[model samples]
Target chain A: MKRMKKALERVAETGFFLCAAAAVLALALIVVFLVAKGVPAASKIGLWPFISGTVWQPSAEKFGIAPMIAASLLSTLGAAVAGGLIGLACALLLAEVAPRALAGMMRPLIHLLAGIPSVVYGFFGLMAVVPLITQWFGGTGNSLLAVIVILSAMILPTMVSLAETALRAVPAAYREGSLALGATKMQTMLRVTLPAAKSGVLNAFVLSTGRAIGETMAVILVAGNRAALPSSILDPVRPLTANIALELSYASGLHEEALYLTGVVLLLFIVGINIASHLALRGGKGGR
Target chain B: MRKILDALGYILLWLCGALSIAFLAVILIYVLSRGIPGVNWQFLSTVYKPGLGLTGIRQIIWGTLGIAGLTLAIAVPVGVFAAIYMAEYAKRGRVLTAIRFCVESLAGIPSILYGLFGYTFFVMQCAFGFSLLSSALTLAIMVLPVIIRATEEALFTVPVSYREGSLALGAGKLTTLMRVVLPSAVPGILSAIILSMGRVMGETAAVYYTAGTMAKAPQTVFSSTRSLAVHLYLLVKEGLGAGEAFATATVLIVIIVGLNALASWIARRMSQRFTGGAKT
Candidate 1:
């Protein structure tokens, strides 16, 4: 009976090991499959032209993605800067200024915002944000500015929560020290606690930037799907993600392969961002 | 100058907080005002008739629930066991590092890439076609990292004394983990499941291609179907059914809010139970 029980334990251990390894296997499969399918198309189109070509005429096999690349970069930068500032201020309010009761009430609401679906955000953006932009700023409501506004809103919850956590993680002693040194409450918060928590705040910004870049569906609805470089903020522009989603369905043959190649480009951007976030996190550990 | 700077700081913080709240209020008010009128008994209960113009989202609701259920069913066991291995068994080593890296990478990859992968690997290579099975499989992979992280955190919180006590009683490693550690971690696991359910319900890009946009109810797991989020997207994309689109978006938001509340309630109740019992 003891031997039988031992055998069962061994089996369970092996089973758990396999389960743990599933993540590695899944990641491997995704990278391998995407590269395998996308490489041939990239090779045919030539890497430089595929990435730098301004025209996206699939009929003539012209598949440059310069415009989409520009749109993605510009929108991500705009959203991250806008959202990061607001998120930092909100984090300060929640972590330092607000009473416990009020902060408690607001946290869950923020989480609910985070839970709102991207498609719903898209629909809301089209009906609410787009029209406001059109009425005030002119051009079609669907433009890069609209995409930036929607994405900033979409990423706000993540940014606030992360930055709040970072702020809270600062030791109480830091604030006490500042107070003992005759620093005013606001001055202590801005100087001692904030500086100590700087790395964590930066980490929040980096991760939120990743979220903005990865956002697709909401961007699609508001970005106007125009595969052209925007001369101004109101001009409609497609990001790399929008390009992939808009054409993936009807695409066949080379068109399909090119879309997969777009996926590859987007994947590389996310991977790079993740690496930067990883570095930021590690740097935080060392600073502490 | 110093006083002025402090005043400006306070004003900025208050303005930022109010702005965040304002954004939330706008979305909620707009969606509810436009959508609540359309969400009636017929809209909630009746079947969809695409050609005849009767756009009840009953089938899509079932499709969303079905996908969520199936995806959770597949993800939970694998995720729990994986968390167990990492928390209870694994030590500092290269293998563990690799696993952690993979989990992080999985968490960061965009949902669209998951969609493309599901299309190529599950729908085509595995010959599952555009069906619920394929979509769930893809989502199962996507949510694995979330479940693993949450469960690992829970497991870490389980006091070492409990495991030691079980082992002293001659319970094997597996038995101790199953009886002591897992029971203690149930609340965390439950919350994680609820969170993943919300995500699975709200997801559109990943599910769009894997689960083909068939307007009718799926007869089997293999049958192509449309989730509520996807249905809303299609409605909005086609631009013909404004009322239906708002109603669908409203339904999705309601379900998400419900799930969020349920998760927080469970977490609060569990903590209260622990603290209240400890006093005795």
Candidate 2:
């Protein structure tokens, strides 16, 4: 009986170990497939023309994605800057100032914001944001401005949640000491606590930027998909993710490869930012 | 001077709070106003036509449920077992660190890339083609890490005392884990699985590649099917069905919010259960 029990225990333990390693297998598979499939296409396009050329007329056999690259960066930066401010303010309210009941009510609502599907956001942008932009700004409704607005809203929940966690992690002693020094409630929160949690705030910004840059569905709906570098916020522009999404279903041959290469570039950006944010978040925790 | 600055700061904070709430209100109000009128019984039960884009989304809704069901069924047992290993079975060492690293990077990988991978690996190489099974597999892989992380946390929340108490009563290790530990951890684990299902339901990009764009209910797991999110995307992009698009969006939002609330309530209950008697 004892031998049988030991054998059964060992087998179950081994099974769990194999189950735990499933993530390892999945990651390896993704890396292998992406590289084996993506690298050849990117190389065939010639690195310079692929990354630098502004024109993206796939039928003409010209596939420069620089304009799309520019649009992606521009909108991502816009979202980070705009969403960062609002998110930080909201985080401060939730973590530092709001009544417990209000904060409790709002926290899950914000989580639901994160839970809202990208397509729903896209629909909202098309019906609500686009028309508003056209009325106020006098250009096509689907433009960089619409993308920026939608992306900012999309990133806000992530930004607020991370910032709130960082703020909550700040030791009570720091706030107490600042108040002990006769600092006003607002002043202590703004100066002492904010400065202390700045690294975490920066982490929030990095992660939010990653979200904005990689965002595909909503940006596609609102950004006009014009394949041009926008001269202003109101001008239509196409980001890299949108280009891949819009054309991949029908695209074939070099056009197909070009879209896959576009995915490669996007994966690079996401991987880089994710690594940076992870490091920043870990470092912030250690420092705090 | 200090008083004026302080007052202004307070006002700014209050304004920020109101602004965040205002954003949610605008989205909900706009969607409900536009979409509620379009949700008649006929709009939901009939199949959509190619030329006539305003028919019911019943098939699309079924496809979404089917894909979500398959995803949860595959992902839960695997993820829960994996999480048990990480939290309870494995000793702390290099292998543990490697698994942790995998989860961290996997969390940040974007959905579009997952779409691309699904296309290459599932649709082409395996010859699964554009089918519900392929999409379900992709979604299962996409959400596996999330469920694993959540379940691992849940497993850790089970008190060591319970396990020891069962062991002290001469129960075997496996018996103690299955009978005593998992029961207490069920709420948290169940919540995590539900949340994963919600993610699979809302997923557009990952499934868009593998899930065929067939506009009707699938005949089988191999049959091509359309998801609600992709359907919503097509309706708006095609320029003819803006009204239908909003209605689909409303349904998607309602389901996603309902799932999120349910998962959160379960999570709250789990926490309360461990601390004291069930208060919620």
Candidate 3:
């Protein structure tokens, strides 16, 4: 009986170890695979021209991701700027001014908003937003401006939640101290609490930018996907994600690798953002 | 005067809140209006048709469930075990810190990147070839961080007394974890599963590469299939089927909202149970 029990214990322990090892191994495998495929593709293309060239014609064997990358940066920046300011203001309200009852009501609403699927957001953009843009700007329904508007709506919840958490984490004593020194509530928030929560606000920005950069479905629907450089926000444009998702089906050989390379560039950009935010937050902690 | 600025700030705050709320409402109303009115039994029951009778979302729904189930099966156990290892066994050293950093970084990587990796590794290199298994494995990796973080939080909240009591009873470390810790942390684990389900249902980018957008039921685990998400994407992208696409979106939205509500409820119940048990 003792020996049987011991054997059972051994099996359980081994099972536990296998499961834990598999979790880490899965992550490592993904990173290794992306780098392996992406590096070779990048080497063949020579990183600069591949990223900077304007035209992306797989049929003619000329591929350049510059325009897509530009649209991505432009729309992501637009969304962040629009969404971030509004989200920060809402967070301040929730943290400082709103009644307890109102705050409680708003909390779950925000969560639900956050929980709404990106596909639904995409459908909304396609059905309602794009038409509005076309009516106003007078071109194809799908434009970079449409992408910006929809993305701003999509990223609101993430920004609000992170910003609110950071605002709440600001020590009450700091606010009290500022008030005691004859500063107005607005002054205290802008000068004292905001600076103190700068890291958190920055973290929120990083998270929002990450979402904007990787946004696929909604942008794909609205970005008009015209492959050429977008002359204006009113014109149709293709971001990196839209390019890949729209073209992955018929892409053969080098065309396929080029798409994969676009994915690699996106991955590297996001990973860089993540690492920068981590270091920034860590530095903030060390300073205090 | 300060009074005027205070008033302006308050007004601005409410305006922001109202705008956010309006955006949410518009999305819900638009999707529901377009999707719900179109949903019929035939639509739900039939398989994919290009421009016709029933926009069979049934197969897509089933495929979504299967992939989600497979992901839960793979991710939940590994995540729970890793959480246990971190909370109960691992020391707070450089190795543990590195592990934590990796977990956070994993969570931060975009879904599209995961799709890329899935395409290269699972679909092509491993030669799973855009099957259900490949997509499920890809999703498992995607949701692992959520599960680990939730499980770790739950386990951390299980007070030191439980471990002491188990040790006093002469139970081994592993036994204590299995019998005492996990039962108490079951609610947290359930919430993690619920959250992951919500993600799997809504996800588009990651599964697209790993799971081919074929509108057919799988004959086996290795067979290719289209999930509801990919199904909706194809419908909209092709522009051949608007009515069907809206109906599919409505069904997907209902399921997603239901799952989100369920997760929130489960999380609340679990935390309540923990507090209630602790008081006793």
Candidate 4:
């Protein structure tokens, strides 16, 4: 019986280890497959031209991603700035001001916001926000600005939740000390709590930007998907994510490979963002 | 001046909070108001009409469930066992760090990249082709981090004393884990499963390429299928049916909200149980 139990333990341990190893294996597979598919195409196109060339007409065999890259960076910057500020303010309200009951009631709304599928957001954006843009700003309704608005709204929940956690984590002593120094409540929050939670909030902002950068369906629906350089925020542009989703269905040969290369670029951006967010998190821990 | 600025500051905070809430309310109210009117029994129960994009969503619903169910089947056991390994068995060291890093990296990855990987690896390389099996396999990998994190957290909260007591009473480690640890972690695992289901159901880009946008009911796991989210995307993108699009959007929102609420409720209940148990 003891030997049987020992054998069983050994079997369970091996099985559990394989399960854990599966995660590492999955990540490794994703990186390997993406690079293997994407790199040869990158080399053929000459890495610089593929990244910085002017046009992206896949049918004509031209594959440039500069415009898409610019669109992604600009829209994410806009959305992150807009979403991050509003989200930070909302976090402050939730953490420092609102009654516990009200905050509790409000959280589900944020979760709902987060939970709603991007396609639904895209549909809503197309039906509602696009029309408003056309009526007011007078473009094809689908433009970079519409992408920013939709993405900012899409990213709000993530920003608010992360920032709120950071704000709540600020030691109460900081606020108390500021109040004891005769600072007003507003002044204390602004000067004491906000500063103390700065790294965490920054972490939240970086992560939200990553989300904005990665978002695909909603951006595709609203951004008009014109793969070209844009002179203004009102101009329609296709981001890198949109580039892959829009074309990968029918694309074959080198064009398909180019799309995989697009995914590689996107993965690199995500990795960079993750590293930055991780560092920001570590910075918060070090400060504390 | 200081007093006035302070008043403004208070107003700003309230305004921002109100604004965030308003965004949620607007999206919900807008989709429901526009969509609820268009939905009918025929739309919900009958097979979808291809190309027309107007008649029904019975197939889409089934496809969504199939993908989500299969994904959970693939993900949950592997995730739970992985969490068990990390929480109950594994020691602190480089293996733990490597696993943690991979999990975090996976979590941060965008879905479209997963879609790309799914297309290249599952569809082309593995020859699963564009089908339910491909999408499920892709999404299973995508949601592993979520399940592992939640399950590990739940395992951590199972109370060391319970394990100690079982072992002291001569229960073997494997037996204690299976009989004692898992029972308490069910709520967390359930919540995690529900969360991943919601994610898989809502996923569009990753599923779209892996599971081709065929409007017919999926005949088997090997058959190409379009999920509800992807169906909605096609409806809007192709300008197929505006009213139906709205209706589909509403259905998706309703289900997603329900799932999110359920997960949160389970999470709340689990936390309460653990805290209460600790007190006793």
Candidate 5:
């Protein structure tokens, strides 16, 4: 009976181990497959002209991903900067100033915003924001500016939640010490609290950057699918995700592979950002 | 001077909150106004036609449900088990640390990259041939991190005393986890499902590659089908049909909102029940 019970226990333990191992293996397989498929494409294209050239013409067999890369970077940077500042301010407000009731109400609403579908945002941008832009700016409804606005709105919830969490993590003693030295609430928030929470705030920004750079549907609808660099914010421009989504269906042979190469570039960029943020947090912990 | 700064800070914070609320309101209003009037029983029941009147989104709806369900089925057990391993079984070691890093890294990778990976591997090599199964598998991969994190959190919240008591009564570890820990963690697991559902519903890029855009419902697991998100994208992009897209968008929004509310309510109810049980 004892031996039987021990055998049963071992079976359960092995089953649990296999379950965990399978999940990790699945993730590893994805990364390996992406690299294997993307590398040959990158090698054939010589990497430079494929990523740096501005024109993408499948008919002519010429493909350059420069515009998409630029648009992605520009819009992502815009959203991160704009959303990061607003998020930090909101976090400070929630942490320091708002009454408990108000904060409680605001917290879930913010989460709901985060939970809303990106496609819904696309619909909103198409009907309301696009018209507003076209009427005022005298350009096409779909442009880099439209992408920026929608992406910023999409990223706002993430920024707010992360910043709020970080701000709350700041020790109460720091605030009290600053107050004892005759610092006002606003002054303490700006000098002592903000400084203490800087790494966390920075982490939030990095996370938002990842969101913006990879955003697809919202940006795709607003970005106009043009393969040229934007002369102005209102000019139609394509990004990596949009290009892939638009062309993935019919793209054959080299063109399809090149598209995968674009994915590799994007994956590398995001992985680099993740690694950097992890290192920064680790360093911050060690320093403390 | 300090008074003015403090006032400004308060105003800015309120304004930010207002802006977030206003954005949600604007979206809901626009989607409903444009979409709701066009929604009819016929529109919800028929397959899409390119040139004819606005056909139903029934096929896409089914496709969406099929893919989302498959993703949930694939993701939930794996994620929960992995989380249990991480929280309860794994020792603090280099391997565990590496797994933690990988999980976080996976979470941060963009949906677009996932699409790229899916297309290259699943569509091209795995020869799944751009079917619902491929898309479902990709989505399962995409949501793994969210599920693992949520499950770990839920497991962590299970009181240590409960486990101790169960063990003292001679309940084996597996029995304790299956009978006690899992029931207590139901709400957390549900929240993860809700979150993953939202992601799957909204996803366009990832599905676009692995699941080719077919107007009809998939005939089988191997058949191609369009999800509501992919359908919406095609409608808007190709300028094929406007009213149907709006109607579909409205339905999508309603479903997403309903799921979100249900998730929150379940979480609250579960916690309340746990508290009530603890008191006894």
Candidate 6:
């Protein structure tokens, strides 16, 4: 009986270990497959030209990602500028000044915002936002401006929640001390509390930017999938993610490898953002 | 002068707060007001109609639920066991720290990367070829971090005293984890799974890449299928049925909101139960 019990225990332990190993295995498979499959294409295309070339014509053998990279950066920065302002303000209201009942209602609103699907957001942009832009500002309406607006809305929840958490983590003493020194309520929040929570708020910005940059399908539907340099916000631009999603189905040989190479660029963007956010989180921890 | 600035500050701050609420309200009202009228028995029950883009969507709903269900089946057991190993069985050391670091990094990865990997490995390399099983596996990988983190947290809160009491009563560690720790942590685990379910249901690009966009029920796990998310994407991208897009959006939003609310409610009730249990 004792031997049988020991055997059962051994089997359980092995099962648990294998399950834990599966996570590490997944991480391994992703990196290896991406690098192995992506690097050859980048090397074949010449890393410099592939990254900095002016056009991205796969059938014509021209594989440039400069425009896609630009669109991604522009949209991310635009969304950050827009979402950051609105989200920080909402965070301040939630963490500092709003009445308890109002804040309570607002909290779930933020959660609901987070829960709403990205495609649904895209559908709204397609039906509502695109029309509004075309009617008001002109152009075909599927442009960088629309992508930024939708991305800003999509990213708002993450920004607000993380920023609020950071704002709340500001030591109570900081706000009280500022108030006692004859500062007004707004002064206490803007000058004292927000400054103290700077790292956390900055972390929120970095993470939200990551989200905006990584978003694909929503942008695809709204951002006119024109693989051209966007001269202005009104001109439609194709980001790297949208580029891959639009073409990978039919791409083969060199064309296919180029898409994987595009994935490599995107992976680098995401990894950089993750590291920055992680460091920012660590910085916040140290400050607290 | 300072008072005027202060008042202006209050106005701006309140506007920002009110702005978020307004956005949420507008999105909900906009989708529902236009969508509810469009929804009917035929729309919800019919299969794909390519020309009109008017899908009955019964098959699409099944694909979403089936894929998400498969994800939970694989992820929950693996996540729970992994959490068990990390929290209870493993000793504190470099291995534990390494695993924790990997988990955190995995959480930071964007979903689209998962799509590329899913397309490359599952669809092309493994020859799953846009099948339900392939996308399910990819989604399971996508949501693993959520499950592991939540399960680990739940296990951490199980109270060391309970472990000690079980061990003293001559139950083995495995038995104690299964019999005692898991029972208490079930509510938290359920919330995590439900939240992940909502996320998987809402996912578009990854599933689009892994599961080919054919909005019909799979005859087998290996057959290709499209989820409601991808269906919505196609509907808009093709300009098929603008009105139907609203209807699909309404259904998607309702399910997602309901799932999230249920998860949060469960979490709240679980916390109350713990507090109440402690008192007793």
Question: Best candidate, lDDT-wise?
Answer: 4
Error of 6 at A109 (Å): 1.0
Query: What are the clashing pairs of model 4?
Result: none
DockQ of 3: 0.63
lDDT (C-alpha, whole model) for all candidates: 0.91, 0.87, 0.84, 0.92, 0.82, 0.88
Q: Which 10 successive residues of model 6 chain B have the least lDDT summed? A: B271-280
What tens digits encode model 6's per-residue C-alpha lDDT throughout B119-218? 9999989999998988989999888989999998888878889889999999987889889999999999999999999999999999998988878887
Q: What is the interface RMSD of each candidate, in Å?
A: 0.8, 1.1, 1.7, 0.7, 1.7, 1.2
**Residue range A1-288, candidate 5, lDDT tens digits:** 877877987787777667667666776887787777777878887799898888889888788999989988988888887777777777777787789789888878777778767776776787679889999988888888888889888888888888888888899999999999999888898898887887787888888888888888888888888999888889888888788777877888888888777777788788878876877577657756
Number of the candidate with higher TM-score, 3 or 4: 4
Badly placed stretches (over 4 Å) of model 2 are A285-288, B50-54, B277-280
Cα RMSD for candidates in order: 1.5, 1.8, 2.1, 1.4, 2.3, 1.9
lDDT of 1 by residue, B79-179 (tens): 99999998888888998999999998999988889999999999999999999999999999999999999899888877788899999999999899999
Q: Where does the lowest 10-residue lDDT sum fall in candidate 3 chain A?
A: A13-22
TM-score of each: 0.98, 0.97, 0.95, 0.98, 0.94, 0.96
Which candidate number maximizes DockQ?
4
The model with the greater DockQ, 4 or 6, is 4
Query: Tens digit of lDDT per residue, candidate 5, span B21-133?
Result: 77767777878898999888888888777566547888889999988988899888888888888887778998678777777877887887788778777777889988988
Q: How well is each residue in A1-288 modelled by candidate 2, as lDDT tens digits?
A: 999999999999999899879888888898778877767767788978799988899889899999899999999999898877888899999999999999999987777789889888888998889999999988889998899999988999999999999898789999999999999999899989988887888899999999899888899989999987778889999998899888988999878888888888888898889878878878877875
Instruction: DockQ for every model, please.
Output: 0.85, 0.76, 0.63, 0.90, 0.63, 0.75
A228-255, model 1: which lDDT tens digit per residue?
9899999998998889888888999888
- For all candidates in order, state the fraction of native interface contacts they contain: 0.81, 0.71, 0.58, 0.90, 0.64, 0.72
> Please, what are the lDDT tens digits per residue for candidate 4 over residues A212-265?
999999999999999899899999999999999999989998998999999999
**What is the TM-score of each candidate's chain B when compared with the real chain B?**
0.96, 0.96, 0.96, 0.97, 0.94, 0.95
